[model samples]
Target: MTTSSLEPSEIDLTDWDFWARPLSERREAFRALRQLPRPAFFREPEQSIMPTGPGYYALVRHADIVEASRRPQDFCSGKGAINITDMPPDLNEYFGSMINMDDPRHAKIRRIVSRAFSPRMIQRFEDQVQAVADQIIEEITAKGSGDFVADVAARLPLKIICDMMGIPESGYKTVFDNSNIILGGGDAEFLPENDEEYALKLLQAGQTLKDLVEELGRHRRENPSDDLVSALVTANIDGESLTDQELGSFFILLVVAGNETTRNAIAHGLKLFTVHPDQRELLLADFEARLPGAVEEIVRYASPVIWMRRTATRDTELNGQEFKAGDKLLLYYWSGNRDESVFTDPDKFDITRDPNPHIGFGGPGPHFCLGAHLARREIGVMFRELFRHVPGIRSTAPPDRLLSSFINGIKRLPYEL
Candidate 1:
């Protein structure tokens, strides 16, 4: 419990080493991170004020991330949501989502969503996912080759979420476009610029999702169906149902969560396979047995949900380092995934990495990712179909990483499907 045993000055938040290099050069960065004198998570990278105007400390060590994630009380979620953009202060209360709440409120919202992603709820989607995967692969295979990002990863998740919400086929593109605008707003291909233009684009995206949620809520209210929107419309929480604002925020969470993360996971998963072709062939050869491990490896390698933010509720010591009340902490899950202390040969994509404790979907805590099962199901199915039908689903062009340091990932992976 000696506080400065691990000096705060030793950490480097801007870790340009791994982040600066292209994808092909990232392994060296991970290797270098492994050789650092102390635990990388405990390393203090440069601190900067966020666009939202809050100051935060970024945590990179595996143990520290696990501790922060598990201790949601002293470290609260309300510090901010996963993104850095400022939520208009006046509208903050309404945007109070499960991802942005602490303790009881966070648990409450999670329970409501759990209803939609429970064992029974998720089971219903298995056949649907396989079917969609089959049809899409059939088209891609016939064409012989195409950009996997466009031909596959970007297509399936929205369709699945829309089906779950009973949304019409036409709404898929709008939902997809809006998520890209909000989540990848800083990515040049997605939104182009990071000035006021990007902020305006995010507001526009929020308005679109807000409008869709309102209309969907109204429809479900009038003529209830077996879809999630309908189920939520009639859902009672502590004998009280979701109000319009609650309904809107929850719906936005579902659609955004259901789509973006899964898409990134799949796209990034495929890229990992391309980089580690040996592992790719190994999974394809014994797919049924190796597929689950392959999924874990991809999640570990990609770490799609790069980081999640927390606010310090009280003056405390994390890993024996002092932090003041109201200080922001950015828990870098990406670094945790590659922690050498946890995995032998952490940089290599081994489909056989047993005891894979990667924090891709996050770990034990109040805000652990709820959509993990669905993500695994979706990514597993997509890879299965890609290997089976696409023959050689490897990248044909160099992949482009999204510009935003948050939720960092590939923007375009031009693969020959």
Candidate 2:
């Protein structure tokens, strides 16, 4: 429970201070964890929301994460995938989406919502993405320099998601702030100082998002627009349509997951390119040919959405490690992306790294990120516009990272054109 009690080499995943450490130190700690024969176990961090039940195993290695993801029946998500603590059923109305669900219900909701992200649907938004990226680039270029995160990286995805869901521009700030609070993970900048206010703030934020989307969903149900809300509220999937609560929860999942992860990826991409000029040069040399690889490398290197939890459904063994029913495991995707056995020179920022099987989106499972294709397009398009119009644009300082164990977020990044 205290830093003095832990050995220097024995990293405690549950410790909040461990997340506060510098990136390099955290990377070294995970490297040591990966070297271990089996996943490391740690007690749950104390929280006001739920009583600490059992501790969780840290699935830090690429092989272990992959196996766990592949065997969803053995390692289930219905107990709660986003938070390490057991989420109360009352909170599920706002926070539970397909990510927190297991098969049947998860599959049905995913099948219905997946239509909005299908290739045809994404192709329709391709022009919209380019237009938004261009608009953002122009706005930032006029200013010449500022916080790239707020100015450039955050705008594209937020606008695209809002536009897709028929959320008016007036509500963009609401969606943005609420999403930040929902995933803020006790960051002081986004949360109140009083611990008593924490749960209330979270519930209020979730309620705001739910109310915003449910109201829009009601309108879409009546008016029937060409947006995702209209499609989702009306679409029949095996004689089942998403209820208002389902729509609201899915909207929270979509906006928060879609907006924050892509924003961080873009922020991290600029930082990575700024640090490794050679890779930037290689990317700029043939922007069209090499960009696909660069985008993948960015997601791999950034590894946004640090980890997701899975509960053991039955007693089973994974890669030589055994788990009892109701056991908890945190799959550290960032660590998996850096596993030495999988990636050669894992620390290097190689834009041309081939066959990169990074689980930045997520491991191979039903819970893999649904917005990945959209995220890739958003990242790729934004960079293309930046390289074409502002080739010299780069981060001027290290990022102000979010203080969270879950999200690999950059709160702010000073940049120049």
> What TM-score goes with each of the models?
0.88, 0.97
RMSD of 1: 4.9
At residue 141, what lDDT does model 2 achieve? Answer: 82
Candidate 2 stretches greater than 4 Å from native: 1-9
Tell me which residue pairs clash in candidate 2: none
Q: On residues 1-417, what C-alpha lDDT tens digit does candidate 1 reach at each position?
A: 122232344334454443544644443443454455444433333323223344456576788889988888888877565644445542443343677776676677677667656566678887799999998888877776666677788788888988888889888888888877767734567774446665567678777877887798898899988888888778776876667777777666767776877888898888778878888889878999999998888888888877877777899888777777977777778878878888888778899999999998876797777778888999999988888876577887777777666666666788675
Evaluated at residue 60, the lDDT of candidate 1 is: 69
Show the lowest summed lDDT stretch of 10 residues, model 1. Answer: 1-10
All candidates' lDDT scores?
0.73, 0.90
- Candidate 2's displacement at residue 179, Å, is 0.6
